[model samples]
Each structure stands twice: as C-alpha cells, then as structure tokens.
Target: MKYFLYWGCSLEASGVNYLRSLKPVCEALGMEFEEIPDWNCCGASVSYAGANDLAIKVLNARNLALAEKKANYDIIAPCSSCYIQMIKVNHEIQENESLRERVNSILAEDGLAYNGSIRVRHIQDVLFNDIGTEQIKRHVTKPLNGLKVAGYVGCQSVRPYGEYDSVHNPVVQDKLLEALDAKPVPFPKKIQCCGSGIFLPEMDLCLGLVRDILDDAVSHGAEIISTVCPMCAMNLEMYQDRINEKYGTDFDIPIVYLTQLMAVAFGMDLKRDAALHHNVIPPENILKAAIGN
Candidate 1:
C-alpha cells in the first residue's frame, strides 16, 4: 500500500518526530510512505477566519495536487487541523462545482487544479481502517496491560459535516488503544474541543476549558491522555501546570501522541524517539509500573 504523507505546519515545525516514528511503523507493516512534495501550510486557523470559502478550497486543493503528482495514493495527515482542512475542501469542491471552479482559478497560477482525484484521511483513520487492528497487534512487543488511557478525539478530527469519521463518540482511537492492551477510559469530554486555536489568544478560557476536560478524564480514572492531534497533545500536556496553579488542583496527567503509545507497546525506545519532549508529566514511570519495569 502506498500513501502520501501530508505534514501540515504544526507537524513540520514541532511534531516532526511523530512523522519520523510513524513512517518506520508503516514500512514495517508493508506500506510505502512518501511525503507530498513542496507541501505548504494548510493556512492554519487564520485562513478560515479571514476567508472561509477561498481558504478551504485553495489551501487544501494545492496539497491534493502535490499528492496527486507525487504518489497518487490517499493522503494521510498526522495533524488533525490539516486533515480537517483538506477533507473540508474536498467535500466543498465536490459538492459545489461553482466554488470548485473559483478555487481552481486561484490554483491555475501554479498550474494546479483540484479534480477531486485524491482522498484525505487522518492518521487514526489510516491506522484503524487501512492498517487494521491485527496488524497493530502484531507489532506489540510489550503490551500495555494495566495502563489506563483517555482517548482525546478533539473537535477537528471528528467534526464538520460529511467527514470521514463520526463527530460524536469516535471509536478509532479507542480501538487502537484497546488493541495495544491499554484500557480506554470513557469520559464525557472525549470529543470536546481542547480550545485548540484559541489557546494563545484566550489564555484563561483555554486553560479553564482544558482543566474541565482533564478533571473529567481524571474523574473517570484516566492516567494518561492519548491524542491524534499535535495541538491537542501540546495543550493537554503544556497547560497542566498553569491549570494546577489556577485551580489549586493536582493535574499531573501525562499527555502523549497515539504514535508514542504505539511505539512503547511495540517496545521501541521512548527516550531516543523524543517521547520525553512533551511538556506534561512523563508517561515513562506509569508505563514502567504497568509492565513492572
């Protein structure tokens, strides 16, 4: 199986290690991974706020063109924001020919067109649907038997109409966690927004929202939070200290990317893989306790 690896701005800037870890795992599972050549930013959140229609159609269409030219396979994005933007654009272009034409006119400058030839998918979708649970299970060298994990789907991965995965009650992350032998803790805020794009502009609101989510997860007995989005991981991990100071609560929950958990279950080196680079509490001690290391 061949896939076009689409790394959005955040992943390229800070989450490159995740792509590094995922590629090796995919290769081991008999999948050919290729990066989309000359991929640009997915316009981040500003594009949507400034020009919703043009932003979605143009930014996502450009990335799709690159994938079509290079790999011609489905594009797999590790970043939830990129997945959302690309999928949103593809849906809009296919559904509305007029909008598609308008966007294509912009792309014509670079000799690119959005023909809807490619499909955009999140990493979780690829892992759960394309890769399958049995294949994931085979890579487990040290199963996470007693580790309790909270699967954070975030808003982007599940929301927006006509998307690949269901918005409410998403199960892909949970399935992946279960397949790795880690217990998936159910919480009411599973699909809740982690104040994603608003983290910087609205610090108090973001921290409060995150605090509530973490409290809910902890209340449900989640020891570590697992997420597919780099922003979600950063928020959940990086904001714990501020939240603790504000609320006088001990929110020591560790945040980890789903890729990191998979690497650990497969007995891959955590330290060397930069798993410890997270700002939240480290998961090493908890994982070690689970395996009695």
Candidate 2:
C-alpha cells in the first residue's frame, strides 16, 4: 500500500510526463510514496561501465541504506533502469557475502550501511501484484474501448532479478491494459532491447533498433505504444525525426506511460491527467478517439 519512491535521475529530468501522470494514478490506487532522502544515482551505465562493480553496488547501497531506515523496506522505481540497478545491487550483495562486507565497509566510513533488506520493485509490478487487475478494472469508468495499445516492457526492469515477473515474456502491462478494455497488441519486439547505453557510442545502431520497435508496434495495428521505461519511451518517442531520417520511413507512433493510460481509463481528464509532454508525436488524436471525444 505504501512504498519509498525512488525517482531515478533520468525520470526526474527527462520523463517529466511520466512523473506527472504517475502521481495522480498512485493517489487513485490508494498508495503512498515517501521519497527516500538524498537518493543518489543508481550507477546506471556510467558507473557500471566505467567504475568498479563495487562502486555501483555501493552507490545503490547508499540509497538502500536510506530506505532501510524506513519501516517498510519496499522501494519502487518508475524508471526501468533504476529498478533493475537497485534490485541488481540487492541481489549481488545478498549473494556475495564478501561483496556485501566490502560495500558495508565503504558505507560505514560514510556513516551508512545497508542490510540488503530493501525490496526494489518496478511500478508496473507493484500495480499488477499489489493492485489486482479486477481492482484496476473497477477504477475504469472510461475504458480504452477501441484503441489498440502495444505493451513495451523494455529490457531492464524485468530481468536479472525477475522479481516482478518473467523476463522472457512480460504480460503484466498487457493484462493490465486488457483489463481496461483496450485491445492489447502483442508485438515481437515488446521485450527487446532499445539500445540501452549504446545510444551514445552507437547512435545509428540505437536508432535502427528503435526504428524496428516502432515499426513493430505500428505493423501490429497498435495506435499507441504503452511503455514502462523512461529510456525506452525516450528512444521510441524522442528520436522520431532521427528514426525517420535514418530509415527514410514515416512513423508517427506515440509512446505513453502505462500509468498514463490507466489514469485516462479511470476517468481522469485527457489533457490534464495524460499530458504526454515528452511524446514527440503527440497522442492527441489517438487518445481522443479512445476517450470518444
């Protein structure tokens, strides 16, 4: 019912729409989120790739340390990268006793230590597991009746830890969307990678990969791509022009947060509840049709 919300760096900075939409959805779901104090980076790609693996563990451990102080050790991250990294750290420290001591040793020097008691969770997981599909359906006064939404689970959030659900084929978002009466477009690229940290060094490769994802959804008759990760949304939605220029293709698919769709189905205002500020191809027409406007 309650969780220590970890607003990852990318989410707070670039995924502002997800933040705005998620707040209202959480309130509607009867959940409370207390932000963990002084939460630092989860060592996303920069630290994990550049610095020591121990550094990544300690970086996440510091945040877990903050969460450990709370009565409930549950920490929920809306960002997929953050969710994976946080849980990855917890899993690593718990499995490797030496690594745990090394992290605790470094933490003790800074008057911080984590017991690995923190339960790192993705928002989608909490929604499906904590709040059942039937409950979610009850909140849906305005169902996405005719709209076709492709569920994009990205790569990170469900993997390595497998806490929320299976990494092979994730259907939580699909099931949740179906519960709202939206036609779930199950595409092949739903669980595929969106380039991850390869966006910088290999922009072309990343663009090509993202293009495939967009095309897959559009080809599958998806009017809107409902996503759970900020990075995936950014790559799929933010790089549209580049994707078009690179592939010489015209794709205008809109990427929305799963929570945004839920909020709309729950009778929240179209403009206010699901502003979709980050989407390059605005979801106006698609969402309007879903809302029967």
Candidate 3:
C-alpha cells in the first residue's frame, strides 16, 4: 500500500541510518512511500513544553491538510515523536469538533482544510499490523539465525496512544524480530524512557537512563538493541562510551533500527542497503550472525 512519509528532521541528520535502511526494506516488502510535499515539523515535545497546544496542533494540521490535498492515504511517520504528534492532532481534532474547526480556520490562511480524511500511522504499526509478520517472513532471504536482539519500543510510540499495541507490554517489534529468526530477549525496560532530547541539557540524567537500558539489555543476553525511534537509537547507541566511562562499566552494544535488521535478513547489502557502517556502534555480531562470514 502507498502512504505519505512524514520524515522528521532527525531522519535527514542523526537518524539517516533509519532512512537508509527503510528504503530497501519497504521496496522488498512492496510498500510504497510518497513524501508529503511541503510538510512542516510535527511540533514534537518542544511545543508541549512551551504550553502552546494550538501551535503544535496547527503545525501538524498544515501537514495533514497538505496530505489530504494530495490524496486520501495514511501518513506514515518513521520518527516516534513525529508519529505521536501527528496522530495526537488527528485523534484530538476528530474527537473535538470545535478544535478541528479552529485548526481548519487557521489552515484557511493557506487555502487548506482538514476533514480528517486520513490516518497517521507509525512505521512500526504499518509493518506489524498492515504487513503481518507472515508477510514479512516471505521477504527474509537470510534469516538472522537466532541473533539475540532487544526490541526497544521507547515512550513516544506507546505512550498517550496505545491503539496499535499494548503500552505496558509491547510485542510488535519483538514479533517482527522473531519473524526474522532473531531471538527477541526478555527485556523489562523496553518501554522505559530513553531521556530523548533531554540528553543535551541533562547529560548526566539522560546518561543514567541510557545506562540502565543498556545494562538491562546486556543482562538479558542481548547482543544488539533494535529500535524504531531515531532518538532512542541515538541515545542508546551514541552514548555507550560515555555511559561506560561515567558508570565505571563496560557496555558495548549495537543499536540498530528494526528496518535495518529486516534489510539484512532480506539479503540486502549490509554496507550499502542496511547502512550498518553508519551506526555508531558497529553491529558486527549481527552481520556475522546473519551472513555467517
């Protein structure tokens, strides 16, 4: 099925690896992604902190209005923060007619109005619900051969909206890993917060949280941590050395996107398609497990 991709800022910069692996995986799965034209930011958490609800809603409304103007297809957001923000606007506007009218009135400035014609879906939901595990299994050419991967769902995707999967106990990512022949380890803190953007101001606080996540994954015998959110991957992968230094521990775990693992299992080039070379923590163990070289 075709969907409009709402690529948040990170995909072009920090999360480029996710963008890289997403392309080949989608192609192999027969999923078409059309980027929304002239889409703006989804306002993410920064807007929430500023306490300007309408501003954030209007930001997402502009994108939704644009997508509706193009065609009536689901908007797929790969970023967890973007997905939550967009879906929040979609859900709230649908439930609150007055708010919808207000948002549309603001959109009138740009000759756009949203009748709530489409749905906002995360890439994780689309891969799990729309494209079932069995369907994904068909595309796997080189199975992971029991690679131990911890699926980090993070907070943005599950919190404030658990429509796709259980917020408390998420299984979508783990299920996808199992379909790829990778062993999804029993990780308790999968849903715990990764301290997201707070890592910048509160490095110590964020580092503590990241350290916990990494420790939990390692304790559970996970060789790699797979996630859907770029922020989560960034926090988990990019801070290993710092975490080790601060905590007086040795934590060396690879953080890879779920799409990357899918690309690898589908026999896509590790360096070219999966973009393993771009990851902060090299997933050499995963490469060895999947390719056996």
TM-score of each: 0.93, 0.96, 0.97
Q: Give the 10-residue window scoring lowest on summed lDDT in candidate 1.
A: 271-280
Off by over 4 Å in 2: none
TM-score, cand. 1 vs. native: 0.93
Please write out the lDDT profile of model 2 over residues 1-293, one tens digit for every residue. Answer: 78898988887777877887898888898998899988898877656468887778788898998889765648889988888888888888878888888899999987887877778788888889998898888899888996899999889978866776787988888898898899999799998899886676788778888988889999999999998887888888878888888789998888899888887888887667766655677887787788786
Name the 10 consecutive residues with the lowest summed lDDT in model 3: 284-293
Candidate 1 Cα errors over 4 Å, as ranges: 49-52, 162-164, 277-280
Give candidate 3 regions above 4 Å deviation. Answer: 49-51
1 or 2: which has the higher lDDT? 2
Candidate whose lDDT is highest: 3
Residues 32-59 of candidate 3: C-alpha lDDT, one tens digit per residue: 8888898888877766788687888899
Stronger candidate by TM-score (1 vs 3): 3
Q: State the lDDT at 224 in candidate 2.
A: 92
Whose TM-score is greatest here? 3
Q: Could you tell me the lDDT of residue 6 within candidate 2?
A: 94
- The local lDDT score (0 to 100) that residue 32 gets in candidate 2 is 89
